[model samples]
Target: MKFLEELQSLKEQIKRRVQFDVPEGTKNIVIGGMGGSGIVGKIFQEMYTKMPVYTSDSYDIPDFVGDGTLFIAISYSGNTEETISSLSYAKKKGAKTIGISSGGIIEKEADVFVNVPGGLQPRSAIGYMLMPLLLSFNVVSEKDVDYAYSLLKRIDENNIKDEDIAKKIWETRRIPVIYGIPGYRSVAYRWKTQFNENAKVIAYSNFFPELNHNDTMALRDTYRKNEFFFISISGGKDSRSEKRIDITKEITKTEMEEVVAEGSSQFEKMIGLVHRGDYVTYHLAKLRGVDPTDISSIEELKRRLSKE
Candidate 1:
């Protein structure tokens, strides 16, 4: 959390550059990529206004895409086969296309291209991926930056002892399942993936009303008494799903522990909760007694897939 906390200001320094036109006259939007890069599109779709955004990780373009569509080819490394394949397909169809990468093959193919600074591992650059998209679409506001910063300040003020929280959450050596409302679902997802890649642990997440209606019934499935449960909640009491969250808390008492995220806006709350998750995962890596800075498995997987 401390390391990621340090990057909050760096994230606030949002920058944008003129790339390309919106396919002459496109309306609907489709973002194509995979893994961590695809998550960027999903984050944009969730938070961005007006535009109907869809993210595709497969080779096929969304059926609705056409000349009036804005297709974004997002590959952090610029060389993902699926994203490249989709980029080509979108371009050949004459859809308005924008390419996002660290200067890969997709950069050469895009009509409007953004080559963000490369060299950092793609997963480590999620903020760059998200910020560029927000800047590109002009979706971000001063409020977003201020909100995130305030949340970070609040969390730091609490003086959350990382080692203590780490011990409590990652004790069982099993998996941590995170739950939250739709507004904070991405944070939950981030936590799960962070554990998967960083802590080398399996994790899961679910949202409010959806979980309230169905998942609440399995409170005592007898399979997870000792398993770790994490709940990520919005700091805003008046957030969209606040009512559903209240109901969730009223019901599930002994099952999972709650980690409150401090922020006044959805954007702040989401990032704030994510800050805690990142810290938790990072510390867990250390507690598991593993080095916090290595990911040989991901590189080897990429190598193996490339060989095939």
Candidate 2:
């Protein structure tokens, strides 16, 4: 319920204005973090296309991430080890470092610290995690943001379509394969993780043009064909990608659930689609008789890693 309720706070989260100045001579951007925190970078990369933006999930900084690079570390907990390690690497390379977190070691280590609200699960804080990037980059216009927020604010938290999708996925008892177009690739990944963590089920995601070439062939394996469920997310205005999705469906002849993204702008469409998946995962957890908030396996892995 807490996670579900937090979805409504996205309007407030986007209202946060960040004060960040791009350093003189900064040529590129590298965002470092893992899981939920890192996912924001993926979303930002799609939104901000002015320059090259790279997202790193591992401990090592890329060799080119030096001098003119601006490194931003995002860790909702402020204590994620890999982010700290990457931050250290960026510093050694003479890159300017900024960290966004509720408060943790990153607060002290980063040259610039952005403190967001804490206490909620990292996955549940997407709005808080995403605001810093969105506000700083100005990739989205103020008018578009306001329009998107207004649209999102009016969403029915208990959407019946989302509930029906969840029920269909839960009843299928098959591994889910979610596909997205170029624009919605991050959303597909988010849905996969939501199912893995929230629904406690194995889920996979891939994008259209690329997957149509390779992954679609995997569907031909008759032995395992019936063991998977496919879902396609549609919304991006790319006509070529849309045709690819349609052709893939016809060629594969595999049953796929289509989820149309709702909203006027790209920002709103992405947020609304992600919100839809969040509710679907919540309902799926209920149907699966699992606690959506439970992430004991991840916690256990973190605990064991801390000991090493």
Candidate 3:
């Protein structure tokens, strides 16, 4: 699927609810994935607070992942080496495993498997990777999905602002430094990775209060003013962090583009912000004159690894 089409499919994807019968007595939740598929866990970590959520993008499962753990392995292609290896490790530890993917070894190996729709790139299948987790854990309600779908549909129809933001970033020709405040930390990281893979550009991300301690110095001392394009994502929940974000922009004398999330629910706000970033990435790709769907470098890396 093309980038735009896959991105637009989120509205439809949200309507397709996934049902999982989570094992009783499941106490801890551990998710394993890599790259695009791995991001679902990061986003989930931010939304789910009742339990210990561990997101692993490595070849081995965490030492704490044993019986009574609900281990979810997510790989868009169902073939990611790290995810597959981690799934094996989790199974040995007697964790109840649920695998999510289009189709591959994961389907056969997992204690239970969910076959998400195929043909889209892992990054583009954000809805598919995310919806299952949200629904299974009851993290988001139907109303939240409805609101998010409505917001995304509206954005898809009118994205002139997102295009303008892309143009501004493209004009700088500098690495993007995305900052998220409090609730939107994972969203900021998602924006950074989207810029990296979809825009084919290097991007960085850090959350507020933490970045203030160290990275703020680089704005005035180490890096030139034009070395980075700064963007701040506002969650609107933390007044102190929001004040810090405002102060950081002012003190550094840096021009930072900001995206403030809007919605009644946190889930709606998160999905809306994510969709906005997707549009920005698409427009940036066009400005760069590159194929948004092409990830040849990643493919080549996989090919070389397969040889070994």
Candidate 4:
């Protein structure tokens, strides 16, 4: 519970700590990473898939990547083997590269870099990976990453403060079920992963309209009022699915403590709401007293599976 308070304070802590510049001539960006680092690319996929943004977890670069490509090698620990190998591959391919990490191998020789100060788990540092990604694009004007930052800046979650809500929802051991609209699916997934990695707890998510038919039936089977129902709201001005999500949350108030998303624009509000969830889940990790920075179990599993 105390950790939630710490995480809420952390958003401001790292917000200004890691700002940087995107060099000119940067085009066709490619992010190399996996697991937690890779989620940054997935969020970008959902948000800015329009650009030539590619996320590779392997050692090889895509054929389309070349000197014109802006390669971003991200490995929070500064020693991710796959990412290091990929960056080496990217460099050989003549891509302009940058390293995003907490001063790992990627940072050692990256053309440009932004360091994350989080001691929490890599998965919990999604905001750090996320915000920096947005800033890089906004710096180069490829995406409205700056618009997203401004949206995050304007976020007013005072009504949904993590302290009051954390005491009620995440203080105990309860699996969280994150709900969001179609457009905000990425945000929902972020919440789920933060709960799992940082909070070190089980969590799940389902989108609106689609969940109405399937997830609604299993709602009662979830088996506890202790679990929190996070509602990631995206004001869908161009789509009706967002409104469906709002209604779904209203109808399901009987199931759990609901935290709604808030923002003026869809992109702004979606990212803003996600930021709060990020803080909440990371604190949840701390409340449970996990390092939030380690994932040895995941690494072991990956290692075991790779042999197969």
lDDT by residue (1-308, candidate 3, tens digit) is: 66788999988988888869989999999999988999999999999988999999899887898899999999999999889999999999999999999999899899999989999999989898899889988988989988888998999999998999899888978788889887788889999989988899999999888898988897766546687888888866667877888898788777788888878888888889888889988999999998888889999998899788
The digit string of per-residue lDDT tens for model 1 on 101-171 reads 89889888988887776666566566666776775566656677677766656655553554466787666
Q: Sorted by TM-score, highest first, which candidate order results? A: 3, 2, 1, 4
At residue 3, candidate 3 shows an lDDT of: 76
Clash pairs for candidate 4:
78-104, 78-105, 120-292, 121-292, 121-293, 198-285, 199-285
lDDT tens per residue, model 4, 2-63: 44443444345335435556556667888888777777776776666546778887877888
Worst 10 residues of 2 by lDDT: 150-159
List runs of model 3 lying over 4 Å from the truth: none
Number of clashes recorded per candidate? 1, 0, 0, 7
- In model 1, what lDDT does residue 287 have? 79
Candidate 2 wrongly placed segments (more than 4 Å): none
Compared with the true structure, all predictions reach lDDT values of 0.70, 0.85, 0.89, 0.66
How far does residue 258 in candidate 3 sit from its true spot (Å)? 0.8
TM-scores of the candidates in the order shown: 0.85, 0.96, 0.97, 0.67
Error of 2 at 6 (Å): 2.1
Position 182, candidate 3: lDDT: 74
Candidate 4 matches the true fold with a TM-score of 0.67
